[model samples]
Target: MTTKITWLGHSAFQVETAGKTILLDPFFTGNPAATVSADSVAADAILITHGHGDHIGDTVDIAKRTGALVVANFEIVTWLQGQGLENVHAMHIGGSHAFDFGTVKLTIAHHGSALPDNSYGGNPAGIILKTADGNIYFAGDTALFSDMQLIGDEDLEVAVLPIGDNFTMGPDDSVKATNFLSPRIVIPQHYNTWPLINQDTAAWETNINLQTSATPVVLQVGEHFDLS
Candidate 1:
């Protein structure tokens, strides 16, 4: 089967594989780079990497309307439930779970977790998806970490990383991360949203292309990359 990975701008993504539509950090409401409205998309599950307002964007509204299962850290899941979202699965870092779509493992990420409502969100995480097509690593808003080499053991087909500097790793660090993960394909994210986090993605892509064995796939918002 073919797996489709769509960049929704910022760090938001839509992954379709094995008859399931999984959304990661589905922020859209206030996102200037958003391509789709929150309620307009269909999903089987929603994956949250952290509780930040941008990352958790329209989870409450989308989940309630579509009845999609929301997956996140314990605190974020609890907070979502309190917001009247009934279907939720709470998973923490270093834990892996299997759903109908595929398998998911949450990896460590160097970032903070504070919900929009001031709730105590748990640790931020990078999510790994193992599917029939291949493995995809979604490195949520994070800084460069050495443990990414450990994550490379999964034999990943693609890796999604942040290149925005202020809140996450910059171009140089993201290139370092690409070398550490060493996936077949690497995609850049979490940049160009605003001036503070702005980045020259083409330059970053060029740097990665020269420094790493991985192919740097710089996607415009809503563009799709398929692994068949």
Candidate 2:
């Protein structure tokens, strides 16, 4: 099966592979960058990277409506259960789980995990997906770290990173991250959602071409690319 990844704006992504539709950080409710509505998207599974409002956008509504399995850290899982969600699976950093769709391994993410209500969200995480088509790494809101070289050891087909400066790493650091992750394709996100986090993706793509070996693919909101 082919793996298709769609940028749902910001750090949100829709991954379709192995007959499953998985959503990562599906924040569409108030996202200015989102072209689709939270009411329209379909999912078999939802993965949350942190408890940030943006990252947790519309997850409850979407998951409840679609009966999709929700994967997240313990704290976020507890929070979801508190909000009356029953189809949640909790995992933490360094933990890996196999699902009907693929295998997901959570890696360390240097960021906060406070929920929308300021509840403890648990440790933030980056996700590594091993699928039939290829491997993928989704580096949720994070700063550049050296351990990404170890992540690169997975032979990633693509790496999705945040490039917004105020909340996450800016473009320059994202370029450096690509150098570490060394994926065949690198995609940028978590930027241009608002004026505070706005960035010029074109310039960042140029820098990625010059400084890194990965091909930079800057997808527009609602655009998608195939893997394998």
lDDT (0 to 1) per candidate: 0.93, 0.94
User: After superposition, which runs of candidate 1 have C-alpha atoms over 4 Å from their true positions?
Assistant: none
How accurate locally is residue 123 in candidate 2, as Cα lDDT from 0 to 100? 92
Residue 88 in model 1: lDDT:
94
- lDDT score for candidate 1 against the true structure: 0.93
Clash pairs (backbone) in predicted model 1: none
lDDT by residue for model 2 (156-179), tens: 999999999987899999998998
Relative to the true structure, candidate 1 reaches a TM of 0.98
Write model 1 residue lDDT over 79-191, tens digit each, in one string: 99889998999999999999999998999999999999787898999999999999999999999999999999999999999998989999999999999998999999999
For each candidate, C-alpha RMSD in Å? 0.7, 0.8
Which portions of model 2 show Cα errors greater than 4 Å?
A: none
Worst 10 residues of 2 by lDDT: 161-170
Error of 2 at 83 (Å): 0.8
